[model samples]
Target: MRSALIAGTLLLAIIATIFFDEVRSLECYVCSRQEGNAEKCLTTTKTCESDENACQSEIRWGSTPYWSQGAEKQYYVTKKCAKKEDCEEYVNRFTSSCQRIWYEDWKCGECCQGDRCNYYIIMGAGNLKATWLLSLVTAVVIFRHIFAS
Candidate 1:
């Protein structure tokens, strides 16, 4: 009887974890060539197609030669649903990270899993690198501390 109780408890815990830990469908911010980091990009949300497993954000510059934000008209951002494999492929092929080149006209692509995981993506070179770097470092420290114990 005690053995049966232990088995049942273990099964219950496993099932509970499976059900509670991860989400089935991914959500992402949906914006297209929005000028600047518009407020709409931050607040807008959408459920991606079932096949899309990730969210992607890119910084685009149009017809600008200078290495600085030319104008609100020149700088734009597009954040949308993406497939994890595709986004990763581009990131691997073209650049090391979405950060760097915080100058101007830097084509940045980044993807993440989980619901609304791409919410932290910011435009512009300086702020984008700093924010993402800070977030990445903080997350690393937290995970290390949590797992090290």
Candidate 2:
């Protein structure tokens, strides 16, 4: 009975470590962006004039939704441009479908700012740390069971 208990504990510890390790390594792509300046207004083939001077924008990372306790949180990353070419390049990086703002068009919200991107990375790292700690605890438990038994 003692041996069985020890073996069970060891197995549980190993499973916990694997679970936490997998969670720690989970790559949840949040968002990233490159910033620049604008210089001129470029017209698309659709007759839409994307002002080059209007600031370049890039969605370094796309938006993702997080849900908790009946609340939903959205996250994304965006880069702003200071020159016309910069803004144009930022806009051009996406497909024509992503350029639209209204219905049927995708638009990035305020949460998609550069500062938020930093926050996302920080939070992601915290999650990773938590997972790592869980794995470490599991490893310690397993080691204790193996040698102390």
Candidate 3:
């Protein structure tokens, strides 16, 4: 009877791990159209949706408006988490020369895999956490089974 209970508990734990993966989220910088003179953007973290797995950044440059007398150029930057399909589509669309309109100039976009890649913060420790958790869970189950038997 005790063994059955232990087995059931282990099964539940495994099921929980699988279910958790479906709801797993990635952290991303979510901002657009921010204005600042600083080259690095001040960012806020967001929990990305399940479909959004890639980090993305965009930079755009535009000619000065005719109404403006200043010789300054216009620039915009954005960062966010994006869906893989959308990222591919964006690459296909923007890989060529930047689009130009009467007043608008060319824009550049980039996509990267892994967490916070768009921000250039590279660390694989987060991925190891799940492995650690599963290992701990497995060890616990084995220990419990040995003692219970």
Candidate 4:
């Protein structure tokens, strides 16, 4: 009975390791943009397609200076599974979808072999600009009211 118990435990351990490896191999996050007021966006897990082996995260920032609101900045972040070659290509270069937004203010692309590695991406500049603009507007309104009254 004792021998049987030892053999069963060994078998269970082996099976557990195999199952864990299988589950860890192909998981990734797929999302077009991050949302909410949180510091980082929450991403859902997904199994990568058969041809995909790398996790990739990409961010694009656009700037426009046409208005009185100062330079408006736009950001787009994406996370997904992709082929290794494609991931490498993206890392070296980027393509712009909008012709009008000539200044791609900032861009970042990362590729990783591990599962779910593309989960978190943060770009502080855009958020800081937005917050600063809000504060400036608020201060202007407050001053205007004080002077008028």
Candidate 5:
């Protein structure tokens, strides 16, 4: 009986801790195209500033001559942590569409909430957290209520 009571109390404490946990700042992929290498951005991540709640990505596409046969197209990308408002304004600046430059280069950008949301140039927020902790707490609460009654 004593062991059962102690276990129940421990479970409740764990549940309460989870409920009162501090909120974490959003994390995002952060890098820029350097020396024509955009892939470097894929390996770095940053915990965004408290006010920087969004992930932003910009992609630039252009055509380059391929020696003889034809012109090959290529794109460079950049990613960073940003504020939602700034990202929204940028995405909306072009009427939600890519802008054409020099008739060959196209520039596009996007923003998203959640961690690593800017990992993809065009994708939105990442997957949400699982709810198994909530379910476990609920189950424990019900068990304790039944035991007390």
Candidate 6:
């Protein structure tokens, strides 16, 4: 019984370590339009208007407006590009350039330039750590039970 208890405690400790280690945050780039006109494209003032009803809505998630702040009123839009390569591709594909900015945690930032800019934010960590830790603990428990007996 003492041996079993010790083994279980060790197993739990190991599982906990792995669980914490695997619980890393993941960042994704988000862009949004600033609350100003085109002439002030250099301004970095913007805010994310979250709509619980439209969390999954496919509307513009970034600050780039549909219409240009310039003549002809052509609209410029922002898209979420996870990878740097993807961001570059977006700029190239859309015939528009973008400034990439890094953001920590899950908080959103305002637009920086051209009524829009790239910002990074945490999306979700999921159950990866828990799953890994559980598997490890189960394996350790089985090994100890079989070998000790």
Q: Candidate 5 lDDT, tens digit per residue, 1-149?
A: 77567667767776665554325687888877532324677778999888887888887676643434455657767788898899889877854447555456577778877667676676544434233356476667767765886
Candidate 2 lDDT (Cα, whole model)?
A: 0.37
In model 6, what are the clashing residue pairs, if there are any? Answer: 31-62, 32-62, 32-63, 33-62, 33-63, 66-75, 67-75, 68-74
Query: lDDT per model, in order?
Result: 0.64, 0.37, 0.63, 0.59, 0.69, 0.35
Candidate 5 — which pairs collide? none
Ranking by TM-score: 5, 1, 3, 4, 2, 6
Which portions of model 5 show Cα errors greater than 4 Å?
A: 1-22, 34-38, 63-72, 96-103, 125-149
What are the per-model C-alpha RMSD values against the true structure?
9.0, 17.8, 7.5, 20.8, 6.0, 13.1
At residue 80, give the lDDT of candidate 2: 32
lDDT measured at residue 9 in model 2 versus the true structure, 0 to 100: 77
Model 1: residues >4 Å from true position, as ranges?
Answer: 1-23, 61-74, 96-104, 122-149
Best of the two (1, 4) by TM-score: 1
lDDT, candidate 6, 77-137, per-residue tens: 2223233343334335533222232221111222111112333111221223344656676
lDDT of 3 by residue, 1-149 (tens): 77777777776777687566545787666667544213444457677887898777676666444546555567666778898679668857886746644365677677665555565422221323454467578868766886768
Which number leads on TM-score? Answer: 5
**RMSD after Cα superposition, model 3:** 7.5
The TM-score of candidate 4 is 0.51
Which candidate, 2 or 6, would have the higher lDDT against the true structure? 2
TM-score, structure 2 vs. true: 0.27
For lDDT, candidate 4 versus 5, the one ahead is: 5
Q: How well does candidate 4 score on lDDT at residue 7?
A: 50
**Residue ranges of candidate 4 with Cα displaced over 4 Å:** 1-25, 35-41, 64-71, 95-104, 122-149
- Model 2, residue 26: distance off in Å is 4.7
lDDT of 1 by residue, 1-149 (tens): 55555555655555565455334566788888777667877889998887887788776655444446444326577788888799778757657444344443456677776666666664221213243354456556555655555
User: How accurate locally is residue 148 in candidate 5, as Cα lDDT from 0 to 100?
Assistant: 82
| Winner by lDDT | 5
